[model samples]
Target: MKKDKFLFLLSKKLSNDISVEENELLTLAINTSDEYKQLADKLTKYFNQRKAKNSKTDKLRAAWTMIAKAEEENFEGTFDYAAPKSKFNIFSFLKIAAVLILALASTLVVYTLQKRSQQEIQSFNTGTTKSFKLLADGTKIWLNKNSELSYNSSFGKEKREISLQGEAYFDVVKNSAIPLFIHVGNITIEVKGTAFNVNAYSGKPYIQVALIRGLIQVSHTSDPENRILLKPNQKLIIPKALVQGNTSKFDIEPISTLDLLNETKWTSDTLIFRKEKLKDLAIRLEKKYELKIEIQSAQLKERRFSGTFTTETIKQALDGLKLSYPLTYTISNKLVIIKD
Candidate 1:
C-alpha cells in the first residue's frame, strides 16, 4: 500500500473512527512497515518538544490546531487526511480531539517501538575462543575472547548501528546511503566500507581502532565536532583518561602493514606481541585462556616481551614466556601465578 494511504488508515485507527475491516488492515500494515515506525518516532519527538514548551489548557488540541494549519499550508489540498480549519468549539473539539488522538497514537507507536528496539538487541559474549557474527546487513564480525557486540535485529532499515566492548574485527558491507556506525567506549566509528579491528576493553587503559582497508571517520563523545578520518593502515587510539573524563582529545597514529597484522592477528587464534609489557600481555593471556593470571613480581610485570604463538596451550605459551625472562609460573585450579 502507498505510504500516504497507510498514514490515512493509521489516522483513522488512532481517532477510533476506523471500521472493523480498516482496523484489521491497519494492524497488518503497521506490523509490516518499519518506515511508519521511524516517521512516528520523529513526529513523537516533535510533539514532545512542543508539548513541553506549550502552556495551553489542552496542549494536544492546541498543538494539533497549529499542526493542521502548517500541514494544510504545506500540502495545500494535496493531503487527503488534512483536517479542515474550524474554530475551537465544543463540536469542533470532538473533531480536534480525533486529530489529537491520531497524533498521540503515533507517539504511542513510537514509544512502543523504541522500547521494542531496546529489547530486540542481539548480544553475544565471547569466551576463551573467538566468536563470529554475521549482522543483518551482511557485515561480518570476529569477537575476541572477553569481548561482546550488540545490535538491533532491525538494523539497516532505518540506521546501521552497533555497540561494542572489549575487542572485535568488523568487515562491513559497503552502503554509502546507510553508513555503519560503531560505538566503542566514548567514541563512534563511521564507515561506508571498511575492514577494521577495534580493542575497547572497559578495564583497559586505551581504546584502539585499526583499519586494514577502506576509510573510516572517528569521533569522540566529548569532542564530536572534530571528526578524524582514518585512511588505510591507520590506527586511532582514545586513552581511558579521555574516555573517563580525565582528558578531552583523541590520540591518532599511523600504522604500517606489519603493525596492522599484529593488531588483528588474534582473530585467527594467534597471539602476536611486539615489545608489549608483560603486565598488558598477561591481561590478554587471561582473556584468551579464560584463566586468572597474577603477576606476583612487580618487576617482571614491567618487563617487555615480543613474540607470536599460535596453536599453543596456555602452559606452553607461558613456558615460552619463561624463555624470554627469568620468570616462573605455577598453574593450580584455574589460576596461573607468575613470579620473579
Candidate 2:
C-alpha cells in the first residue's frame, strides 16, 4: 500500500468502525510490508497513547465517529442504491469504503503522524554496543560508549526529563524556562544550559555527576527530600552505600576541578586519567571500549595508576596499565584477562 493509503486505513482502525475483515487485512498488510513500517509504528504509538489516556467507552465512541465521517465524505454521491448495474459487489463496496474512509481519516491521521514523529526518542540497548546523538532543542548530546538515554517526544515544555544508564556528556543549550533533568539510578540532576559529565552505570556502586560549568541540583529520585546543589567545578558522588539507604545523602567532598578535564577527555576522543586506581580505570576502559576486563588479584586491583592515554586501541590501554603496575593482560576477542 502507498504511504498515504496505509495512513488512511490506520486512521479507520483507530476509529472503531473497521470491520473484522478490514482489521485482518490491515494486520496482514502491515506484517508483510516494509514500506509501511514507519506508518505502522506511528499508529502503534498513537493507539498506545490514546489507550493510556482514555477509558474504553470513550475510545470506542471516538473511533465510531471517525468511521462515520469517512463514509459520509468519500461515498456520498458515488453509490447508486437503485441502479441494478450499480449495485455493489463485496470488492466494489470495500474499495469505495476504503476511499471514503481514507478521505475522512486524513486529518486525524496527520495529527497522529506528527505527534509520533519523535516517538523513537528512546532507544534501548541492542545487545552489543551502540551510539546515538540526541538533538534536544538546540543542544546536542553525544551519548558516550555504552550508555543509553531516553525521553518522551513531548519533552521540554513542562519539564525536560531524560533517563540515563551508563555515561554521557551534555552540552546543554541555554534555556532558563525549561531546565534539563537527567535521572540516573536513584539520583536526578537538574540543569539549564551547561556542560557536564555523568557516570552512572547500573552495575556500578556509585553514580557520579560532574559539572564543568553552570549550576546544577542533584537529588535522589526516590528520596526527593534530600538534595544537593552543585557549583561549577564540583563533583557529587552517590556511593553505593549511600544509594542503598545505608546513608541519607552522598558525601560532600570537592574533587580537584582538574579531574573534570580528564574525566571528559573522551569527548575529544582521548582517555586521560590522573592518579585513578587500577580498578576505577578498568571500569572506564570497559565502558569506553565495550569490553569485559577482569583483574585476577585483589591486590592488583587497588594499585593506583596515573597517566594520559590518547585514543588508542585496547592493546594500548592494556600496555598503559602494564606500565603502571606489574601485571600482564591477555586479550581474547572482546575479553581482557589480567594476571600478575
Best model number under lDDT? 1
Lowest-lDDT window of 10 residues in candidate 2? 126-135
In candidate 2, position 318 carries an lDDT of 80
Task: Estimate the TM-score of every prediction.
Answer: 0.45, 0.45
List model 2 lDDT by residue over 78-164, tens digit each.
767686763555544554564465445455765565566545464544233333343435454645666777775545544577888
Model 1 earns a TM-score of: 0.45
- What TM-score would you give candidate 2 relative to the actual structure? 0.45
Judge candidate 2 at residue 113 and give its lDDT: 59
What is candidate 1's local distance difference test score? 0.73
